[model samples]
Target chain A: SQTIHQWPATLVQPVGSPLSLECTVEGTSNPNLYWYRQAAGRGLQLLFYSVGIGQISSEVPQNLSASRPQDRQFILSSKKLLLSDSGFYLCAWSTTLNYGYTFGSGTRLTVV
Target chain B: AQTVTQSQPEMSVQEAETVTLSCTYDTSENNYYLFWYKQPPSRQMILVIRQEAYKQQNATENRFSVNFQKAAKSFSLKISDSQLGDTAMYFCAFLGDSNYQLIWGAGTKLIIKP
Candidate 1:
């Protein structure tokens, strides 16, 4: 079975500080990885997705950026965090097109 | 562009009763996929059921099933014998066969009162 792991299940960052959230998948290779943010009482917003290493697509324009450093490792980063950046960040992976995504537990970010 | 909609904002059901959540989507693509995801209080998204556009027969899990109407663009989920653990926020999702992205609906909050 495949498993997705995210670091710092909960994070508290100061405004204007930098941010980095890591996601790595085990037991699968060349899987599609995605980054999503869910605001309180809102739908899941797709921030970025990577089909392969060094290939990334941004779904929405925001302060966050994504990178696929390794085949199974994906990273979401920001140089300067904003108050609006606070939300529950999730990382997901899929085997192929139109397949159901397996999401991680998620990282609750609180930017104060 | 594809869009998903969950008309119901919230629904309540008695324990052991059956409940259905409504969902509709808009898309121009002929080939696509529909999915239902569950998000518990923990906020973890879990796949509940999925239906392919080309399949005529409805998809069913142990206690969950989907009524897929391709022409109407409607896909609804029916949960049988609802359990307290089944209480969660349900989201409808649509994905184009050619794209790796998924469009999500706001979600329907389902509560099972015992």
Candidate 2:
């Protein structure tokens, strides 16, 4: 079975600080990876998606960026964080033809 | 562009009762997919059910079922004998056969009172 792992389950970062959240998937290769953010009571907002290594498509212009350094490893980073950047971040993966996405446990970021 | 819509912002039902959450979507393509995902307090996305546009029969998984109306563009989820654990935010999603991207709706929060 395939599984996704996201780390620093909960993060507290000071304003203007650097941010890095890592996500890795095991048991799958060449999977489509995505990054999503959810506000307190709002719907999920797709931030970025990667089809292959070094290939990323960003959905929104914001303080965050994503990279697929390795086939199974995806990272979300920011040079300087903003207060508005605080929210729950989720990483998901799906097969080339599959319609459903399998999501990781999510990282809760609190920028103070 | 495809769009998903969940009309109910919140719904509450007593334990052991039945509840149906409504979801509708708009798309120009004929072949696509529909899905329901559940997010609990832990914020983990769980797949509830899925329906393919080409299939005429609705999909069912144990106590969970989906009513797929392709012409109406409606796909509703029905939870039988709801439990407290069923309380969560449900999101409706649409995926076209050509694109790997999924369009999600603003979720409907379901609360099951015990």
Q: Tens-digit lDDT track for model 2 on A4-63?
A: 999989999999999999999999999999999999988899999998999999999999
For model 2, the docking class works out as medium
Q: For residues B4-68, could you state the per-residue lDDT of candidate 2 as single tens digits?
A: 99999999999999999999999999999999999998889999889999999999999999999
Model 1 lDDT per residue over A39-58, tens place: 99889999999999999999
- The positional error of residue A26 in candidate 1, measured at the CA in angstroms, is 0.5
Highest DockQ scorer: 1
Model 2 CA deviation exceeding 4 Å by range: none
Clash pairs, candidate 1, are none
